[model samples]
Target: MTMFLTIAVIVLIFVVIFQIAKASEYVSVLKGEEVSRKQNNKINGFLMIVFLVLGLIGVWYCNKLYYGKTLLPHGSASVEGERVDSMLWVTLAVTGIVFVLTQIILFWFAYKYQETEKRKVFFFPHSNTLELIWTIIPAVTLTVLVIIGLRNWFLFTGEPPQNAAVVEVTGKQFGWIFRYPGKDGAFGKKYFRNIDPANNVLGLIWEDELSHDDIVTEQTLYLVKGRPVKLIIGSRDVIHDVGLSHFRLKMDAVPGIPTTMWFTPKYTTKEMKEITGNPNFVYEISCDQMCGNGHYSMKGVIEVVEQAEYDLYMAKQKPNYLDVFPDKDPAAAKADTTKTVAAKTADTAAKAAAKL
Candidate 1:
């Protein structure tokens, strides 16, 4: 059987290793323990040097191999994200210098300072100057990095330009719902209790005139290229995150608390496809938070276009109000009114028949 063969092979390998160890012990006794230890130390020291050289080379090789595959080569997709990229590069440069220097000094000392009769270990314990240098330098460097990050964070979360296009992003169980304020330039009042999965996706109060003009869409969001857009974010069921990697922005979508982030588009989706040399390039909205079972499927798309194209796209979208109350949709016309009434009557009659 495979199990019996596997066990027998393991036992044989252990016996062979034990015999080799016993032979080595007998050889050490013949050579003298002190000389054997010295020889082993020399070999280990040489291996340390070899390891240091190979490690440094491996580091260089890895960077050369994978650096091009990262977003750093393509640069940022938003003007604000350019600051993020700058901060990232600065952090990498500073840490990289420290890493290479420390590694070289560490492994070089191990190899060069191997036990020898010519040298004796010094008893010097600690130096205040050395401690201060190590402590102060890293502290100041981290403080500067933190301050830079905070400044960028404030700029991103703050109120955007007056002409900025605003979109309300609501995260649900397995998808994203985007609401754009129509001509009125205001989002209508929304209540969670008014939620109806069939049509009233965002639970906007129909009584509000603002809700009548509020444009709602799913799967894709459209924005004007080179225009600043503010996102008002929230979640319906649990916590979710709106991750816009291209813009280098993300915000949590909490159930009761709303969050906001804004960014200006540097290139249209079409332009990005051309720039990246990919025909199917699209801006993605990824859920950065783990909400529920269907979390992986929660995704959305963004289409950045010119002002005229954006206008045409908006013009074609019907308001959420019309979908919720089809009777009020002007496109349905008066002829459809009777059908609506008939459907309601049929529903009521069907319920009555069921009860009987």
Candidate 2:
């Protein structure tokens, strides 16, 4: 009801203005002057064109102000987002000019031919030249735009550089994990036997294989800014999507196989750290594809740190933490129990064989 009332009030105001303008246009006629409004049609046409241009300009600027991304964010491993951001201003410029020109042409035609009973029509039949020119110009314009867009698209998703840094991204129902290959260029396979039930140890816990190569156990990823980072993403249990709104990078993290994207950082991690007044450059990573109930809270952070800091950080990670149990004496106490069970199983097998 409030919306209706507001709309009605706006209509009434516009009607009042229209009536006033009409009256002013013929004020001399009302005062018994012999002049007709048709004499001033050229002036009215110019005024209408001005109003049309102003209206379109206002709408264009409003759209730019309302819908836009922030200029700064931490590094992202996708380039398409940055390309779109760069092209947005150009899109606005072209759209604004077209909008203003269209409106001006419409209003000028309407006001220039305002109702005049004494005027005779000047009729010209179809002109193939004019028709062909109009059609060809618009076709060329659209083709140019399409070509430019496709070029950017190809540039963004093209094969990444050979030396791009690879980071493994794994997704779960309610959280994210980033695995970095520690010191070794390759990541060790994970086996399920190593999973500790007491601790909520997630992912394919590769018990026997965690020792050949080290995996950094930290939740957040730390990378030096200005370096090319490639993210190889996968999911363990169900389908999930990796989305970073600030960086404009969103991609699906699927199970069974890995999906990858690459990007180079424009800003240094140290610069962002100082600007945000924190040692970390926090980028919110959320799952775009709903895989479970806790999907809304599924989050991850990327920390852009200096190269030296990142090196020191990787060096401090405990490589054998997964295999190292705090209480190591339990195995010694349970050794005799394991031998007794094996002996009982052998005796039962021998008795069964004799009975047969």
Give a tens-digit lDDT track for model 1, residues 313-334.
9889999888777788877866
Looking at model 2, the pairs that clash are 190-206, 191-205, 191-206
Q: RMSD of model 2, in Å?
A: 11.3
lDDT by residue for model 2 over 85-151, one digit each (tens)?
Answer: 6565567677768876777778978887765777788899999999999899878877877787777
What does the lDDT read for residue 103 in candidate 2?
Answer: 72
Q: Candidate 1 — worst ten consecutive residues by lDDT sum?
A: 329-338
Q: Which stretches of model 2 miss by more than 4 angstroms?
A: 1-54, 60-69, 72-84, 113-115, 118-158, 189-202, 205-219, 236-240, 245-248, 273-281, 287-296, 319-356
Global lDDT of model 1: 0.91
Off by over 4 Å in 1: 1-30, 334-356
Task: Find the 10 residues in a row with the least total lDDT in model 2.
Answer: 69-78
